[model samples]
Target: MAEVKASMAGNVWKLMVSEGDSVDASQDVVILESMKMEIPIAAEVSGTVKELKVKEEDFVNEGDVIAVVE
Candidate 1:
């Protein structure tokens, strides 16, 4: 399994996939809004998305797991 974690504290601005979607490494999976920048949360490994831990407009912190892939 692989975890998709937030890089910094931010609001979840977008979610690009749902459970069961296949993804590739470095794919833009989520967009986090912080410090006036749209920081993208990317997949670390290629696999099917298994879970999403945050929703749009949800606040998240650095290192928080935003999704799980397997």
Candidate 2:
């Protein structure tokens, strides 16, 4: 399993993938909004999305797990 984590403290702006979705390595799984900038959080491995730990508009800290891929 791989954990897609937040790159920085921010509000989750969008979810690019949902549970049971397929993802490739380096594919954007989430977009975070911080200081008016949009940052993409990517999956580190190619796999099916197993879970989403955050939702759009949710606040997250750097290093927080956003999704699980397996």
Candidate 3:
């Protein structure tokens, strides 16, 4: 399994993939808003998304697991 983690503290701006969705390596899974900028978090491995740990507008800290792919 691969964990998609938040790179910085921010509010989740959008979710690009849902649970059970297929994702490719380096595909953006979530977008975070911080400091008026949008930061995209990508999947590091190609697989199906097993879980979505955060939803849109949810706050997350750096290193928080945003999704699980496997």
Candidate 4:
């Protein structure tokens, strides 16, 4: 399994993939809003999304796990 982590502290703006969705390495799975900018968080490995550790509008810190893939 792979854990997708936040690259920076931010509010989760949107979710691009849901549970059971397939994702590729480097695929953008979530958008985070911070510092008046939108940042996309990508999956680190190709796999099916197993869980979402965060929800839209939730705040996350840098390096926080946002999703799990397997």
Best by lDDT, which number?
4
User: How does candidate 3 score on lDDT?
Assistant: 0.97
> What's the distance in Å from true for residue 36, model 2?
0.2
Write down the TM-score of every candidate. 0.97, 0.98, 0.99, 0.98
Instruction: Return model 4's CA RMSD, one decimal.
Output: 0.4
With a 3 Å backbone cut-off (N, CA, C), the pairs that clash in candidate 4 are none
- Tens-digit lDDT track for model 1 on 1-70? 9999999999999999998999999998999999899998899999999999999999999999999999
| Residue pairs in clash, model 2 | none
lDDT of 2: 0.94
The sequence of per-residue lDDT tens digits that candidate 4 reaches over residues 20-47 is 9999999999999999999999999999
* 1-70 per-residue lDDT for model 3 (tens digits): 9899999999999999999999999999999999999999999999999999999999999999999999
Q: Considering every candidate listed, which one attains the maximal TM-score?
A: 3
Q: Regarding lDDT, does 1 or 3 come out ahead?
A: 3
Cand. 4 Cα-lDDT: 0.98
| Superposed model 1: Cα runs more than 4 Å off | none
- Sorted by lDDT, highest first, which candidate order results? 4, 3, 1, 2
Q: Per-model C-alpha lDDT, please?
A: 0.95, 0.94, 0.97, 0.98
* Candidate with more favorable, higher TM-score: 1 or 2: 2
Worst 10 residues of 3 by lDDT: 13-22
Stronger candidate by lDDT (1 vs 4): 4
